[model samples]
Target chain A: MRHSTFFWFFLPTGLAMLLFIAFPIVSVISQSVFTPHEAVFVESENCGPFGCTTETTIDQDATAALREAKPLGQFVGLQIYLDRGHLATSEVAAAWRSTDSMGAFFKTINNLPFYRAMGFTLTYTFTVTPLLIILGFAIAVAVNSLHRHLKGLVIFFSLLPMIVTPLIGSLILFWMVDSRGVLGNFLQWMADDPDLSLKASTGLTWIMLIVYGVWHSAPFAFVVFYAGLQTLPQDTLESSRIDGATRWQQIRYVVIPHIMPLVTFVALIQIMDNFRVLEPIIGFNAEAHARSLSWIILNDLNGETQLLSSAATTSVLTILGVSILLSPVLVRTWRDFNSKA
Target chain B: MASQLNKKPLALSLFSTGFIVIWLILAAFPFIWTLWGSFKVELDFFSKADWTNALTGARTTVEYGSPFTGAGYHGAWVQEEFWRSVINTAIVCFFTVTISLTLGTLGGYALSRSGFKYVFWLLIAALIFRAMPPITLVSGYLLQFFNWNVWGILPTTIIVLVAINQPFTLWMLHSFFQKIPKELDESAIVDGCTRFQAFRYVIIPVMWPGVITTGLFSFLLAYNDFAVTTLLLAEENRTMVPAIAAFMGTTQTEGNVMFAVAAVVSATAPLFVLVMFFQRQIVSGLTAGAVKG
Candidate 1:
């Protein structure tokens, strides 16, 4: 009876998810494999002296000619799969030549720029996640340690970045970092060099991106960690202090352990958010650098062929990478919830 | 007694005060710069030599003609573009918040109490949609709507914006709804109220804080959003962020005073009002729904 009731309750959500999310993903995967090249010519009789007809024909004539043409081939099954998905190197190479002019599937792995993008995205996620976590933890602890009256003020200030639009955040950074802008002017003054620009190179751009990310993201982390701190048992800390543990020692041994679950949870959240870091990086720089996965995906979609299949493949990879990276956190959360139950 | 009371931990107080001051500065510096920059006209902002040239003269004409001519700060209040952006942002935010709150609250309540076995997966789906880069969805929707010819029922830009923001509002409201106790629903049902009636009379009133927080965040998110709005919204319908971006992009020739002032005013105004009004709820909502819970 309970199972039936639960099923009834979940049915609408289940159907909606299947239709919108699951279907689109599956469609992308399937479309990546099934679609054939336009090389499968429809008309045999239109194969004129040189080859296929270069002239336009009536629909009736085209239909008749197509019927006269021998059926190009059968559904080659996994060969189509291999060719379309670009899984087989030789097939990929062959398909590349045919598709290059028409702007179709990737001809060569070198043509895709996937590897460089992946490296950049991984570096961005790994770098930003830890910085956000540590900075957030520090800010949270600092706020938590304040006299009760002052805690509100600190939290209110911290919430500013999170509440402001990321576009504005990036714009503010852009203005500050521009050649004639505030930071740039200060740098020029200090160095006595007028030509030094923040966006001079990929490395400098990545650094700027990281600084912007930390500024924008730290508030979120702080809020989460602060809340986690609030939930920590006061008795544990009081007892640790009574046992002659210093404040730092108490935080390290007791408070930190108590908040580990929350930390892990927030870390996973940060990883997901950071992996899709787009606005600040985009607002700051136009080109895709070794910065974010989403930026690479956007760049690919904007390319000549509009190679949505490749974009879809990259999206799937990102989703998988995030899931895999966060598996341990997920497992731990599950275990904790189950144990409590 | 007063002296004894005043003898609280001096080191802790000093440390905290220093920390607060540093954080306040860090948080306030960019805003302060933006505010100051907004007041100065274009020439003063872009001039290589004198950063304070705008403050010193009303319309200082320098001999740097060709590209750098006709640049100086003007009063921010008199700028027409600034007011246009503010009005456009207000309209966009107004619709985005109102629609998202109504739909999100309804959807959240349905999922929370509907006892559906698939509710977890539904929640996960919403999260995935929220987590996916907005560019992907916005690009897809843009292409889809560009080809659309459905008797002009909904404007293409509005549809795209609403779709992109829906997942976020849904996730937020879901979290809010999950936190509400289920017992209230059961008791209301036991009193012969229908499900919808119970939701209307019992669940919504209690979930007011969640709804308000979700609405405020959604409004801010919509107002500040640049990526989706930039791609999807037309120039005439451009929201504040994109308008500022356009201004920033064109600042080399047009100058920066107007853009800077506009950026500062637009970014800070709504945020200030919201933070001030809902300081307590905002703190609790962010920590509870986002971080801890």
Candidate 2:
């Protein structure tokens, strides 16, 4: 395409992304360094009817002027990042000094809001990624062997868990696992303990959330692997069969290798998806028990006060996390582009 | 190769069959259970008194004088005004998909056809943007929207979603356009059509499959979104997903748990029908990025 044509064609999207996506990111970075202004105060004396009385009064006009002068707030670079809600630099140091044992120190750090959410987010991402890969691979291989007519029906059903709204699906599972809900009731019966409740325990809530994550995402991996299976080389499979290799060996040697690239692709996307685990946290109403980094940002931004600075700090951290996760894919894409060049 | 294994070993066959059955049940049962339970009274569905009431619909039978009841749907749709959110979601999804598709197609086509090596960097930028969580951007938007006095409105939310959605749309459509022969554009241009004319007359007609696939995904993103919608939309202009979330914030005495249940099923039904109709496009759209990526 010529320069003029390309310019005209790409301008709209480029501008949209620049103004909305790119500029907001810049704004978030800046906002992280600044906070909202506080009301100004001064001492004054009023001696009209009563004895001279000294009092503190908010200088409303000055406060308004100050706000108008610097609406984004005072610059406080890295302070929000190091605060107890985030990196908790001083809090961790104090906790370390207070604790005589490593176990207590570790526990104290785990209780911090930012560290706690980051811990769960990391654990969920790593656990769900590999688990879904294996599960999706198994389902894809099993479905590939079915009668052609039945494949589509199975796929249609398989997609339901993933295609449903994340909150809605998690709620469906949440209620089922609620104490009064069906599965919860059945579990209580099976355990011989009527007091069993997933909501009351942190471990139980985390388990249910992870299970929901796997259930909701595995179909995506399955469909991708299923597509990859069609492109598998028949000649190699025939050769393996002629060599008297068992089905297990065939899949181990032939099938796995055939879909290795697809596995990487799926893993990349899953990491990106899993790193932003917010909806499930809300869906389960497990904010008391579990929170993610995305949840932290939402928590800060959500309420009547609109804690913009705190939310911006979390956003910066969350973006940093995404960048670290994305670095591997970045390297590969760069290498691929170079090779093509 | 497996078919040639003269007698399919009983253990292997049973294992595969069992796995398939278990997976199907695991995937389908939650929705089915919820759908069935949504139609019943709270006691019968949750069954605090007797677990069997859930299976038997005992309370639902006594209350509604039928095995199934539409009370949940009525409460959610009419009493709670969930219909407003549903309509808002429709408007948002329709506009997001259409506008994003328009901008994405033009941009993607340009990227694919252009010979500049910087196109690689442009796409790489888009890839990074695509990986960003929508919530991360919401903080910045909140302040900006407030300053502009446009926060908590449908149009502003819609435009933001379209912007957030643009990167993925461009990535998918770029790859989609790349697969088309560039000769089509060249031929059209040679025949006296302008570049835009060639894109309109030649490329678009050939690109419906990919466009539809991308559009379906855009619609899903707009529909499934919780973060931006919840934050950016006002209380009065909430969409379905966020509205459902808001239902939980109400006082527990309202007996609106059933309303959420009904909304869940109601929201899910359209997706069920969507998959029924567009399973092929969906399957293809999902894998389209993978093989190419």
Candidate 3:
């Protein structure tokens, strides 16, 4: 544990993070300010015999050379961030001034790409985090009451949703909700309207995405909470039971407090996760209805032009969003560490 | 607190039983239904005439003279070259899990034993790093990977994923290492062993269980990732998840969504097997944080 040994031991991972994780963050922040080179134009003249004419010609070779030499592009600070695709400060102001009512304002603001995406992202994050925690807790409690042999079988199936690839998981659900699929038929039958479709409504799309999020993640919470349940104090439960506490009362008073730390752990992780909700949006083909900050960045990154600057801007905004979302957990962890010390 | 008590609370038991049944159906039915649907002919699975045809394989029986056909799986795995992506995923997962575990084990041990103030802050920094949307970092990597000519290949993507997977692995391994008494290695050091030798001889032998648990998670991350692998990899170099996504994209135009259905079930089978085998390790790995946090 000496300084030299510690340095040597940590060097590889520290270097990896610095080069890949930490360094890219710095690079992304700077890249947001820079852009790819634009084509240069120059007047070209041609003379034949006696007459000469000039035309504005794009200097493609020069532009390619320039881009190759300094590929980071020109530095334009805060411009991209404030543009319509991102912060959209001017657009927001216009929407705010044009619309008098809160509903109207949101209607207009929702037309702006960033705000709309942000709205879905925030709603998805906040709604899914607590919902999954409650669902996971319920599953844990229910499974804990099951017979021992059934426990492994239930847990095995439970782990499937959590372990499967996010896109695959969502796609499986996505297909099921197709009008021709089983769930889709069942849904239409239940509603007594054959034309009823999940894909038509933005509200339904968002609900499906959130449901997928919960289905995919609740197992994580269940497994963690289930494990926590194993270490519960028998004495405390016995004492509570002897006091004529109902099962619900016992869970509310005794069981919950014991697993409160796990709850915090699951909540913190889920919020961080839900904030980066990108894959489900793509998998559900819900991008038209529910774009996330991560999806916006991917949108920019994947196209033919590889909108690096725009993607970088969105990346910066997303990092800021993640930091803001995670700030509470950071502060609590720090405070707890200091107190323990 | 399983159903161990002698006194039968019939109402609670009934409610729990109902909840379990509902949850099990919710959790397990989608895959089972999809699996069944994948085997039947396309129309029989997505029946227009009667919804019961899906159950009856009506068109499937008419076309193939049987209720099932491997045509979708055949189209995907052979015609679409889905196996290339499967192999690519295997390579990426194997290398990523191994590399990240190697780096994470050393780094985690250092953090746990060093007792330096910075160790705490390093982990804190890693926590922040771990939480950041990795796609945000992909923009940074895009220009660099292009400039360095490291883009669109398996090894570069593997190393990048290992780096992204590092923080969580390190945190998990660090917590797992903390549970072992420091004296395990310190005693070996006392018996004429250097620190490195003690770690190699004493600590590592005992670290396999934790590493294997951590390794399963790393494998999962590598296997399950879409953001990093999708962006960094080339068309031919795509992993299974992105390949499946691609299948969804083109299959609609091809009028062959069944290919995607077959691919989905194909992709899910390995994960199901993994869960059945490594359920205990997965659970332990998950709770390693809960117990400490």
Candidate 4:
């Protein structure tokens, strides 16, 4: 409890977080403002019988040496952030000027990589959070009413979707909805369209990803709400029932109010989780039809070039988005702490 | 809370039961279907000729002379050298969990016991860190690790995972430690034990349940991770998730998609067993933060 003891006890974890979490954030910010060095070129004059020509060749060795000297690349301030790959300020401005209507403007903006990803990420985050909450609450209520013996079985099965790796879960669903797979085949049969493919259309892909998101996260909500349900005030419930309240009325007046805090808790956590939304895109191979900020960063970081600067810029923008989403929660927590103290 | 008066109407009961059944099927059917499909050849698993071939393994019978086959598993585990990745994953998970819990317990204990405003700020900082996508941090790690020549290795990935695991681990364990009556440790100190001695003797023994729960989560984070491991590790040092991802990339065109399927099933088996045994701890761990809120 003393200062020195607390210091020693906290040092290891604090140091880990500082070095990895805090330091990397700083590194990402710096990297975002920097671009990789350009290849050095050497020009040579070739003498011929009647003509002379200048031939320029890349000096790979010098470029490699420069890269070696400064692995963080050349600092370009906020150039990368405004470039076509990321914020694309100029492109947005041009699109705004060119498009006559808001819908057309949005359509043009959607063609830009960053704004397109932002649109999907925000939509997925907002839609999935509330939907999963409703679905989770429904499951919690339904499972709560089941026989005690069935609770464990239902819960064990329920946790499977959430507990499995996100990539694998999405992959399983992806295969099932493949054109030749069971669900896809069944859909074709039901709709009487043998050529229908979920992956071919943007709307369907977005829906698929959203459904996957809800399915994957709903169990987490269910568990938390289920726990909140355990400590429900029987006295209040009985009193409400004695007042000739129906089941729905008892729930509306007694149950939902009691679990309101838990609902907020789940919402906050799910918003954070859903905002990332990376693996499912990869697993579903939905990148062609849909993309998220995390997925774009992943795509940028990958492949032959590594695109470090581009990825870092996207990373910074994504972090800003997360902070914007998190600010309200932080303010609420601070207020609660102040009131309690 | 289930009492005589709490009985639902027949229609309501039926509807709720039906809803639960639909949800359970939605939740469990994918894993079950995948597990069954992983044993068949690509054609039968994704049959266009007849959907029933997936269930009956008609093509599998025609080719391998059996309704089921382990060809995909063998192809993935042996031909593609997926076992190495599995071993790498095991090593990463082991170290990440052990080191994360070790650091987390100490820090969480300190934070819980110390009556200071700074403790609140530290947790808030951690909450922010926890919200930042791991992919963002990957770019940072890639730049620094490349500079340090520490990229593309299991140890580096393990340390990064342990660090990422710390925030949630600290938050969970801090809440857990708060629940342990402060008197337990204060009493130990009164008996002439040093703070370290009190922690080592009194707090450590009673901390296992919470620690175990936190460790389970740490293990899950390290195990299920794809972005960090894929980016931070070299081809030879890949973990199972990344390895399976690699399989998807290279094997999709070679009539080897089933190999990726098998690898996915293999990678998920451990988590399946983990949830089976630690369902309660996992649930409690998840709610620990919310309960405090």
Model 1 CA deviation exceeding 4 Å by range: A1-112, A147-150, A191-193, A286-291, A300-313, A329-341, B1-16, B50-88, B114-116, B139-143, B150-171, B248-264, B290-293
> Candidate 4 clashing pairs?
none
Residue A73 of model 4: what lDDT?
77
Between prediction 2 and prediction 3, which has the larger DockQ? 2
Can you write out model 3's per-residue Cα lDDT over A246-315, one digit (the tens) per residue? 8778899999999999999999999999999998998889987899999999999999888988998999
DockQ of each two-chain model: 0.31, 0.85, 0.77, 0.81
Best by lDDT: 4
What TM-scores result for chain A when each predicted structure is judged separately against the true chain A?
Answer: 0.75, 0.97, 0.95, 0.96
Q: Given candidate 1, what's the lDDT at residue A232?
A: 82
Q: What local lDDT does model 1 show for residue B80?
A: 30
Error of 3 at A155 (Å): 0.9
**What TM-score does candidate 4 reach?**
0.97
Instruction: List the candidate 4 regions with Cα displacement exceeding 4 Å.
Output: A58-72
Question: What ordering of candidates by TM-score runs from best to worst?
Answer: 2, 4, 3, 1
Q: Model 2 over residues A1-341: C-alpha lDDT tens digits? A: 88888989999999999999999999999999987788999998888786899899899999999999998788888998999888999999999999999999989999999999999999999999999999999999999988899999999999999999999999899989999988898899999999999899999888889999999999999999999999999889888888988878999999999899999999999999999999999989999999999998998888778888899999999999999999988999999988988
lDDT score, candidate 1, position A265: 65
Candidate 4 lDDT tens digits, B57-151: 99999999999999999999999999999899899999999999999999999999999899999999999999989999988888678768998
Tens digit per residue, CA lDDT, model 4, A78-128: 998998988899999999999999999999999999999999999999999
lDDT of 1 by residue, B49-144 (tens): 766663443334343432222222232224535566677778777877776676667667666665544565566557666665655443334324
